[model samples]
Target chain A: MTELRLMWRNTRMVVLCAISAALYAAVLVPFKVVPLIPGVTELRPANAIPIVCSFLFGPAAAWGSAIGNMIGDFFGGVSPGDLFGFFANLFYGFIPYKIWEIISRGEGPVIRSPWIAVKYFAACLAASVLCADFVGWGDNLLALRPFSLLGNVIIFNNMASAMLLSPFILAAVYPRVRRGRMLYEELMPEIKPAPMPRKTLGLALLVAGEVGAWITGNLLSTGYWTPGFLPAWMAAAPYDKSVAMIVSPFMLLAVVGLCLM
Target chain B: MKTTLYIERDSFVHRLHPTAKVFGLFVVFWSIYWVDNPLALMPLALIVLAIALMMGAWENVYRFRWFFILIIVPTMLTWMLFYRVGKPLITLPPFYVSEASLMFGFGRGLKVGALVLASVLFLSGTKVEELAVGLSRLGLPYRLGFTITLAFRLVPLFMESALTVVDAQRLRGYDFDAGGPFERIRRYVPVVVPVFMGALRKANNMAMALEARGFGRTHRPTSFIEYRMHPRDAAAFAFLLALGAVSFWIYYSGLGAIPTG
Candidate 1:
């Protein structure tokens, strides 16, 4: 009951985390637009979102984000892997949450303790990469076919990807979240009669969603040339996915409603 | 490329119970594997294709039909010509085309190609939300079911955002119009780094939004969309199940003949 009240008290913060997680999952459709490069990989970013979600929001958040991203996978026409689909994302996507869980238990926050973040970072990174690779390899082994070396190729590439990517999601947003938590503590000292403007709230959500999406789209693809083709091969590898891209709007809106929390 | 299994339209395949069709697909696929003779596979493929076509995916077929034809013809030719290991039906010195090989090749090609088509037809024809709902009805947790539905909606949204991100970079005088593929990739570094960071921010926000809406605990959701089982759906399920049984029997009993022997 106390934890529930605490969640209710910081409901706004938690809800934002969920929405962020949903949008994190939501965008990234694999629609086969022009690629910026010829052979550059895309899946790493897809893996990042859920990890980030789990890191910030807690266990429920982690699972929520993974389920969201999986939906995108389903629609993007992921058919061949069969039941392997169930845990494929879980193995790769659950790393950051686990790491964050460990980190959160330390003396201070993950950001202040950069070494704390780094301590298990390598193991976490290696674990996720290997988990993903083994799943792929297992699929081939089951099929009684020659194994693919592509898994190793991907693992090698992700080293730079992790070093470059993980910090920002870990550092910037998380601190803001912690600060936001601080703000939540400051503002909602007790549940006062806060003016709940339903219409105003709806319009705010609309504007925020559109504007946030526009900024994200424009900010990410800063100009590179690739000739457009009809059969646009989807080039998004793994790292580019997020929460907004996947989970249901009804659920998301509810989370958004919690921002009213 | 991510697989394309959805077939877009309001036909029987579109309307059939999502669970049944999922099972139906599995049944058809196993039948493809079970039938020892390749000749028997074609009819099963044809039946799936017919269902997909009847479901209103004619346009998608026209779009990918050439690609399919190209793949099937070449594979058939290669299998019959190169993998020929038996007594020659037609010999060219060291290279010989045997009756068994030819039959095997055709059967393999037809089965594989038809399976591919069946998959494409399924994805292109099916509405993603309906599929999620069906899964939920089939006993997927409602939370997970809704997550799948939301993620489906997000794919296109993100695809569009990715493009918009590219254009935003172009306007900022980012050298998208760079020479050589490598140069273009370097240019996209600026684009990708930020788009990715921005997406994380979005996910964080989305998670928070969802949690705010009284989402964590079980609350009776006011579902805005509804799908009900109808007579047409029942009939399709019964007929397809029967067809699947027949296919299974034929494959196992070897009543189905292949042209090879």
Candidate 2:
């Protein structure tokens, strides 16, 4: 996460960040591979760009993903929910490389074997779930859309791109980036990983918190399960109060976990 | 493709200080966020329309006509699934169409539509540089703001190069539209790889160019354009502040809420 701040100090990292964002918005605006939710979202192959860039550019990719999505939102429509969308994409790009760093034990994200492939999928899934949860929880909190609708669709949209497109892109681009000595670790060697025990615990919390938020968001938004602790008024239809009450702590936990990592 | 929503207009809205415009954007979103009644949302919609008409931003608005429709319709339908209140006018399996639900859904749609319109107006009126300057004035770091402005400048370039790659591939008898949705997306790998590699090849030189020109030699690098607050800007800020206050008052008075009985 320190890299996120440090990347700004280096001119090359700033250029790389701009390039990453430009590539994302370029692919995002013109290409609508599949429209999953009409105006809200689509199955964007462009989603893979962040994951690919994340493996290559580290923190730059995270900011790139956020800003790129902001550019895309400008073209489509911007809303208060897009503030959430921004952070959602930030995590979407941030989580992959961080998780990969831990799970792969400092190895590159180019998938060369079955075990590596599973780890790759896990990283993408974690990223996708948190992204979906953030957007879903936000829309539902605002009473704009049901959490289940966005929560579920975005996961599918992100995963579709990650699973089907990102690996191929990474496999093709990683070695060349490494050869050019342009990978984040190569560009900014000052960044040191946290102790393994803390990072592992952070990973555990991240997974648990994200998964909990997803399930709780879905349940609360659907009116399937209302927690008894909330007042009756808060538990009523639209369930905005219920969602704010129940889902937010999990989201906080996830953020704290990311900070730890 | 035209990558940005900005139009080169010399309207009063365009001439306003970037910080005021940025704050205006937040005020609009803040105003819209407090209401969930279609009727109540109409005033802001009409205000946006008036601004658009005043600024001759109808071109961008007209361009996004279908998108506005798409946003409104699906949003209404999606809320119908979850906002089950009032007497059922039409009871379907998953959807319960009631007066409250219909009004609530329409209100949500209008709210989202208004937010989008406000954003479109903002983007149409504001340039990328102005946005960065506005954000910087509002406390964004200089480097991050520069990165954002640079990314905006690069989107069209990247998109142009990507289209060139697609054309070259097509000339070589490569079919981009040769299969199902996922297959079609997968086929973009070739197009993406070249653009990705091309972008990276520029990164080193771009960094060197910035460094040679003293990119980060100082904390607050001077800009080519300078902005100062005017009487109009102060007036606009006051108007926006009042608008935000009125919105909160509406919410507190419960005039913005849907009657779900």
TM-score of chain B of each: 0.75, 0.98
Report the poorest 10 consecutive residues by lDDT, candidate 2 chain B: B89-98
Write candidate 2's Cα lDDT for B125-240 as tens digits: 99889999999998999998998889999899989999999899999999987888899889889888899999998988999999999999999898889999999999999999
**Kept native contacts, fraction for each prediction:** 0.12, 0.88
Candidate 2 residue runs with Cα over 4 Å from true position: none
Give the C-alpha miss distance for residue A176 in model 1, angstroms: 3.4
Across residues A1-261, which tens digit of lDDT does each residue of candidate 2 receive? 788998898788899999999899999998887788888888798999999999999999999999999888877768999889999999999999999889997678888889999999999999999999999999888887888998999999899899888989989999989988999988899999999889998999899899999999989988899898889999987888899999999999998899889
Poorest lDDT segment (10 consecutive residues) of candidate 1 chain A: A235-244
RMSD of each: 15.2, 1.1
Please give the TM-score that candidate 2 achieves against the real structure: 0.98
Residue by residue across B171-220, what tens digits does model 1's lDDT show? 88776656753333334445444554555456545666667765556633
Model 2's DockQ?
0.85
For candidate 2, the lDDT comes to 0.91
| TM-score of chain A, model number 2 | 0.98
The complex in candidate 1 yields a DockQ of 0.08
